[model samples]
Target: MKLTRRLFVGASAASAASLSAPMVMGQARPRVVVVGGGSGGATAARYIAKDSQGAIDVTLVEPSREYYTCYFSNLYLGGFRELDSLAHGYGTLASEYGINVVHDWAVGVDREARTVSLAGGATLPYDRLILSPGIDFVDGAVPGWDLSAQDVMPHAYKAGTQTALLKAQVQAMPEGGVFAMVAPPNPYRCPPGPYERVSMVAHMLKANNPTAKILIVDPKESFSKQGLFEEGWQKHYTGMIDRIGPDFGATNVEVRPDTMEVLIDGVAEKVDVCNVIPAQKAGRICELAGITDGNWAPVIPHTMQSRIDENIHVLGDASAQGDMPKSGFSANSQAKVAAMAVRGALTGSQVFPARFSNTCWSLIATDDGVKVGASYEATDEKIASVEGFVSQTGEDAALRKQTYEESIGWYNGIVADMFG
Candidate 1:
């Protein structure tokens, strides 16, 4: 049978009625507390609540009232999307799916008691916990730069005011001024994100400040879709973007926000705007919960359960699941598998084997899109990639434009799946 949202809601209600017998016997309903309400956390909360038919009580703990997706913030920088278009509210999740949406910071977690402490001084107890706190920058990852200097050199990775700040900095650059980007190392959020931002920055400059130049100081010798990006840069914005790899001392770099100068291997260059994306690790709450292995939280591939605590699950960028790049699509996909597992564990629902998929689409210029994608299945050891595909160089413009359109459709669909 084709499962629609209405049908799922009905099924959930039926399940809840059947489970009422246990509640009448003095047993409590299963409780799930989700921390972070982005692609992973929101989807997990919605699915568990909607599919369980009120058999499970789900609480979502997020500090922000509105979430701005980091996925398409680069497009906002390029003027392809509006800032408001990237923002979403949790009202639908609460009103439609019967979720308890709490707007507060999740400050701590007590695994022993299965409770989450909030900044508002309330403690939420849960039978299962899902943590998808996203990415946080490492301290001292880039010398002379820290969170305090973010105003001067905006990371814009979290996608809100910082995104607007970076865009303003780029647009406000002097004629022929330099825009510098300090790219992060490997194992960061969105493997292709920094490069995509560079592309969008180039696109913006080409239209506004045609003479402006973009400099990339990258730690890695190579990057995701490097060939495709270079080809697009040369074709679309020739001589506009220059990259310095680690061989040229990209790894050993320091930023002086006070002076607007970046030191690359003892050589300093003054830039009109600096975008420093530092080395990243799992969000702070993971460390607080003692579930992370110093950087990222490890999880069982099939269930996305924490390796340290089976009752707590980790999803999205915070999870160190093998072979899956930390993308929103990956997080959303993992959330479904986790939701099913959590339901089965809590409500005696049927559990299915886990399968996952991801696609990362990046726009190089107007109507010029490229993509990389893969499908995976859970193995005894990890989430192994079964097959993959990438956009080839020299693809016709029609295909590229079609690819761009597909990405837009995906954005709408995924957000609906997450919020509703």
Candidate 2:
């Protein structure tokens, strides 16, 4: 394959004598323990395993055997894609790539010992650790909302059953009823996720319950692709959606799952379905690892290595890397960079300059898609955006449809790149 920044698996590598290796040369091979089986971790594990060619031992620790993609889940809610299509397994990585896939939760990390303790009473030692556990909701972010209340007012941000539950609740709503969403604050996973979800919800409601209303209680004043989403909402689902920003007291929001009511600025509003995407931080395991600065783990942009600990590398939404939006595309991009850096460190392989890129696609209405993307370079400070592009506000139907088609192709390509 051609050597691009995105696909650097087979690119530049120079062999070195065994004396140059980081770990003990004769006793065992250099071991890499990757936490989380999502975009960043999976891609990192696969790339390292494939590129290193058995020079390193790669063990991927993910609780779930079947991983789901949150990228195109909005399309699933809009009925454009099936749930099964978004699900992928670890069989290929385990069987074909010689990766030790452990279907268990990583509960603790011993940085000094370089060992990871799992929930299943297993201790795995490693020379390097990659953390891509994704985001977890901050406690008390939405008043009266927590993990327990998820059954009544589901935060379908994690995909899988939560996504299915939210979809079911929308389908079971009363005719002309309301569907409310509590949008998250800044620096959350998937910047345009909530808006795309609103568009998808509106798409479904317009067909089934035309009089159904969609309400957004957002803390942020403006969001990614605001113009594109607003224009699409007007053209596709006019009068069906309403947004309550900070100006309208959206910041002071609370939910009552027991009563199915959302208190927006102390005003109790009843809703048929509620998706409360609370404030997000790095996964809880990051706290266990003791590497987070505030809510997220800080990483050196060049290698995606945790600033607190050189052996640990943080990726995706859990990282406080600058500029890049917390999206699957961003995570995957970072994974390639991390994979290359990890291999070079462990096996004394040649390392190239770190380059990253990401694109986030949102389906507003049927065959109507909008996107924002950028190519980045690793600067001394952060991952700086070198170039960018976004979908035009007023594009022809053919162009919009083409963009939608492009998104589908991307979905296929990314999953293949990740799982395979």
Instruction: Report the number of the highest-lDDT candidate.
Output: 1
Tens digits of per-residue lDDT for model 1, 145-255? 999999999999999999999999999999999999999999998999999999999999999999999999999989999999999999999999999999999989999
Leading candidate by TM-score = 1
Cα RMSD of predicted structure 1: 4.1
lDDT of candidate 1 at residue 144, scale 0 to 100: 94
Q: All candidates' TM-scores?
A: 0.95, 0.95
Whole-model lDDT per candidate: 0.93, 0.91
TM-score of 1: 0.95
Backbone clash total for model 2 is: 0
The digit string of per-residue lDDT tens for model 2 on 145-221 reads: 99999989999999899999999999999999999999999989999999999999999999999999999999998
Q: Model 2 — TM-score against the truth?
A: 0.95
